[model samples]
Target: MTVTEQTFWVVIPAAGVGSRMQADCPKQYLELQGKTVLEQTLAHFTHHPRIHGIVVAIAEDDDVWPTLKVNTDKPLYTVNGGAERCHSVLNALNFLKDKTRDSDWVLVHDAARPCLRREDLDKLMITMAQHPQGGILAVPVRDTLKRVDVACIIEDTVDRERLCHALTPQMFHIGMLREALEKAIDEGVLVTDEASAMEHAGYSPLVVEGHGDNIKITRPEDLALADFYLASISDEAASDYDGLMADDG
Candidate 1:
């Protein structure tokens, strides 16, 4: 389908305090390459021609959002978020109930994951077109994983095969996702992400392969990593442009 013909919306959950980052502001508000992490994250969807609109769930007392300048032509809506990430995502979904159709795609992305590549996002949109239950952008686990105990001792070495690190922009039908999240919450199932909620409802979400660099900025160290990834992406784009110029010459 053409870019303008594609119909999908994005929901970003930016409510968390991000205590793990140990930052003065939420991790999403932390500076990355001059702009806040949330700003960079929003740019991905906002720039994509396929995206119809975006809903951001922020804290009720958030004063920083008003200060930060984000430029986008797409319709942006903000809602009061709940106590946790799942609640915030649910709130955004509820905001879309009357605005979107039941079959329209909704992508739930983390506000701190600013390094989501355009190629990966494109791949996700294409892959989910045929997926009834929808899918997520994830990378297969590469390292030897360990099942650890509370004492910080390794209990056993877990098999790496069939294990994938779940990433964001988890795409699903707005109606299906809202229903999944509502049912999961009603059953007291604490879903960490949209795919988990779908899984709890007995629906298998697809795993579309993505790069490992689609990292979520959780700790202070992750900011550095995200900066590195962003720089690398810029360098790659420049290289491609130079190659095209040389080919024309």
Candidate 2:
């Protein structure tokens, strides 16, 4: 949205090992609905008319390269990821940076997030188109909050008025993103996300409300929910994964 031209590139960082999900397979490769979660996630942007191309950063040992059975291979570029998620993203940008100009816009997305809705993407783009600052997809925190000490005892109920959960396809001007990431790297500063790096470089991003259904399939219950969501959609829109036939223990 903020990036209007043809220079917009979608960069997906799928290098995380998903240690929190406790899955034997990488979280992105795990099946949701009928397709691999990453495939469903890619389907959203791959079909977007303005998206110039997609760059997927997978771990060197990740089986996603082998198991993912996608056919539309136009703007797809594969690169090896680094040790940390930020490093993986920066590495992807580094490779893409040479192939792209500094002014190109990069939409950094998480491969594990497959529940992203089309309307949300359009909303973000439209919002970004109106702003000159960085952009983030987020929703205001609606639940009560509590702060706990190191021993797990509730320290106090912190104010929830200003809290919001961060989501992706965080979009930034490619050259600016590269410079910010490079600065962090040079300073030996490890950032948790691209927006954080941009913020550290002194840019405030605008947040847009996101849908609650747009869930990340991180746990087994999440997988079940994704399956139902996929079942409701048409077959063509959903991806089929024969690899999951061996999912039963």
Q: Per model, how many backbone clashes are there? A: 0, 4
| Local error of candidate 1 at residue 245 (angstroms) | 22
User: What TM-score fits each model?
Assistant: 0.92, 0.87
- lDDT at residue 155 of model 2 (Cα atoms): 92
Candidate 2 at 99: error in angstroms?
Answer: 2.5
Clashing pairs in 1: none
lDDT per residue as tens, model 2, 90-209: 888888867888767788988877767666676676667556765888888888899999999999997989788888889887888888888887888898888888888888988888
32-63: candidate 1 lDDT, tens digit per residue = 99999999999887766668999999999999
Q: Which window of ten consecutive residues has the lowest lDDT sum in model 1?
A: 237-246
Instruction: Enumerate residue pairs that collide in model 2.
Output: 1-125, 1-129, 2-128, 2-129
Error of 2 at 103 (Å): 1.9
Off by over 4 Å in 1: 1-6, 235-249
Which 10-residue window in model 2 sums to the lowest lDDT? 240-249
Every candidate's lDDT: 0.87, 0.77
